[model samples]
Target chain A: MTTDDLIARLTGELKPVPRTAVLRRVAIGLGSSLAASATLMYFWLGMRPDLMTAMETTPFWAKFVYTLSLAIAGAWALKRIAHPLGSIRINLALMGALIVAIGILGFMQLAMAPPEAHYYLLTGHSVSICTLNIVVLSLPLLAGAFWILSGLAPTRLTVAGAAAGLASGAIASLVYSFHCTESGMPFIAIWYTLGVLVPGLIGAIAGRYVLRW
Target chain B: MNPVEARLKELMLASLDGDAKSYGVLLNDLARHLRFYFMRRLADAHKGDADDLVQETLMALHTRRATYEVDRPFTAWLHAIARYKLIDHFRRNRIRATVPLDDAQELFAQDQSDAAADRMDVERLLQSVPAKSRDLIYRTKIEGQSIAEVAQSTGLSEASVKVGVHRGIKAIAAKLKGGADDDR
Candidate 1:
């Protein structure tokens, strides 16, 4: 049909679109998802025995800051990227800077520690379990992210998914930290970061299939 | 810059708020724009598909209207969707639509054709790209060479060649949009 003909037909069939309750959905979705994950972590694994003392330690706070920063950035990016024309370049750059800072701090701590303690710092008390716990805890958040994104029109699906995964993983790491006993700065910098990024990679791969509208 | 754009943005925002009349007008204006946009990019042989793309783009905009950010520039969002529809068309018929060199020459030689003018516009836009990337884009886009073929001819990995071509097109689009500088 001609353009004018198509327009006429479309106009005749036009229906009013309801206002999108995106902001409300985001608040409720993320808030409840985080609460559920936190509750599960609290009851299932229990808080670390020295929870009060850990709160006072700089290392513990460092880990918290690291994960929380990622969580905030990723969440913010996800919100904007729900639009087809949204650009996440700034958020991605900030995230990159955070990684570099963490990496530098990790190496510095390693340098200061004695040679014999190097392996202990690198290996940590919990390697496999920490990563797995972060991934598991991120499930609810990831689901929430998917819910938020799939409801929108994100053209860059892989990037949107990666942002969602990053947010989920970071939030998971923050909750997991309450139960984790590891205080090694280097270990947190390395393994904790990996835990968050692993899900990001998974999200990127799955985005093509899941977010294909 | 123009009142038409400002008017379109207002109509779009109104449409989001359930103003069916404004939505219809907005879609009608967008359809006209898309017809021109698609026609400029497509060859004469594929001119029929321009209307199809316009229809498809409008349908997408209708369904995804809820995602539109009122604060952002409307044209950017509109163009992004239009570009994706164009890309989807190219990908769907890449093998069949890749014009041979001889056919491409004939197609461009006809100065009277709108396709030839569009081709010239594309070339001028692409002049901003570095020499190497321009050649890669020429081979892949105009010559219709596959990524593997381009890679083999240039002795670059298929991945890099693909990236180069993608970046080149993106750069050209950016320039066309009046972006200050090339990021790549």
Candidate 2:
């Protein structure tokens, strides 16, 4: 074969990568995050033995209103920063906003605590606080990692990132379960939401660099 | 028995006898024959898919050899596998046959034989290119892919893909032009 022929033949070869796998990974991340949130909410309800009574009171209603406002704002920030299309600026911005939102939420919880406090509210055996923190902190980190990793065009990087995020989340969730035996269902829903969010964010940031495929 | 069939049978036997390395050598040689088989019909010689099909077939053979019946003629089974792998490759890559049934007979009988000549030329060229160059060539041209896509798919640095693609193209071009130019 002559050089020109070889060049022409070589010029025509192209590799095919499958798109379906990337989409599946993203779907899994979203489902996992939603489940973590539900668990946190379950434990939250158990923490405040008097939460139902407080719900009937003015202060309880006020805190509820405040928390609801924070929730909406957090959701908005999440959408803006984690734009579905995925740009670096949008991602970093999203992470920064989420951290701020979580900080505010932690402070608000302390503020809403009653002085006469149910032993559960103060040094509580309640699973509510722990679940809430874990869920809140972990979701973003793990979710971000999985979403970003799977999108990279390189099969190896995508596979590696996916495996790491999935394994870590599984491990972390097990560890959290042992620590939050007292969390109310609602607490678990909220705190676990935060926990996952943190790891998800870390994963996302790391994926941007590693999976540049 | 045909010489090719006898060779393939020998290759299979060697593979089954625990000479795993011989299987690869057999597949490499078999790929050349497969290329010739497809070249008779493929119009675009550079449509690197023939090679892809050959590789896919070899993979299927390796993975599913245990199912092969010793009592059956080896050529029949090998040809069936080759045909199946070719179809599988098309399905996976979304390639379609443009000639409908109404046009098929006419196209087969009256079509220009240009594609066959080009396919032969391409096969010769491909067989001579270095392995690395061949891979890059296959990724860029036959796959009809962008450099970024190729890099992403292959997990190579973008710089490496760029350099490799350029070098590979130059080398193939040089080889095709014969020994006349040392410009590369």
Candidate 3:
């Protein structure tokens, strides 16, 4: 009816909302989706057989750090963009630095290795299916992030979508790492990054249509 | 931040704590500001839509209150939501160009013929709704009467009055959509 009447109704029904409501929702969305992704990974692609041995290796830890850092950056960006007028520049910068650092590490590894091993480092054993798996695993996480975003205020739909996509991709990569035996920095820099980007691209496009209030 | 922003932020913080009175005051202040904000961007011919937009934005602010971060500048968050609602309104109306606030004077200079025509069309559409619901919608929406007032006058419960007004609006909207589809 009238603005005054609407305001009256709104105030009348007002309840004390928890200060951490948004954070809680984000956590729930991420936690459940992560569990779902992990479950899917365990069923579809069992963990690496040399689980005890891989834990003590440098390359394995490198892959873990790279994916984990990216996931954190994506999450930071997503949280920021979930608010109205929230800026993602810092988050983007952090993510960019992480990628460059990984790239540098991969380059050094390639350079030190013999030229004949260059192809092996880059392609690893699963180049054909690595990116595909990451993309597929990201679907559940992407859905969860979108669900969380739909309930919040995000002014820049495309950007917010991209953040959600990036976060989902990174987190998916982390989950996929458990099953992946490839320890090459070059493989992770090339294929893992692509897997993350594919979902980010999908998120940007789908967000424009789905993230509307 | 300005004193106004500080005060609004304080009120919002209180409102989040379930202080209804403070919340009401905050909403009233916001409504005044939003009226001026929407009135400026809208063309003169479509000024009647300004209040509708204001109402829509207020509703969004209410539903998405949890998204407001306590540490962030309150005005920036409010402005973003307001601008988003305005953009959505423009897109729905297929309004490609907007009158800048600087040229708001030009808005008053334009004729009201289009608005008058729109009112007539709305009156025609209102006829399709049932008489009881139509009366409720008219009293509450056009007359700007409170739901409680309407309910008391009509001997109907407030909930029923609310439902009647809601149904009436939905019926009119459905008819308008049908008309647009026929034109297409």
Best by lDDT: 3
* Local distance difference test scores for all models: 0.80, 0.49, 0.89
TM-score of 1: 0.69
Error of 1 at B138 (Å): 28
Q: How many backbone clashes does candidate 2 have?
A: 90
* Candidate 2 ranges beyond 4 A from true positions: A1-25, A28-86, A105-109, A112-124, A127-148, A154-194, A201-213, B1-184
Interface RMSD of 3: 0.7
Candidate 1 chain A: worst-modelled 10 consecutive residues by lDDT: A16-25
Better of 2 and 3 by lDDT: 3
DockQ head-to-head 1 vs 3, winner: 3
Tens-place lDDT digits, model 1, residues A1-213:
776776676666666665555665566778888998999898889899999988999988998898899888888888878888777888888888988898899899999999999988877999868888998898888888888887777878789889888888888998898899898888888888888898888788888668765
By summed lDDT, which 10 consecutive residues of candidate 2 chain B come out lowest?
B99-108
For candidate 3, lDDT tens digit of each residue in A52-96? 899999988998999999999998788888988877889888988
DockQ values, each candidate: 0.30, 0.02, 0.59
Per-residue error at B77 for model 1, in Å?
1.0
TM-score of each model, paired residue for residue: 0.69, 0.27, 0.77
Off by over 4 Å in 1: A1-22, B39-52, B89-184
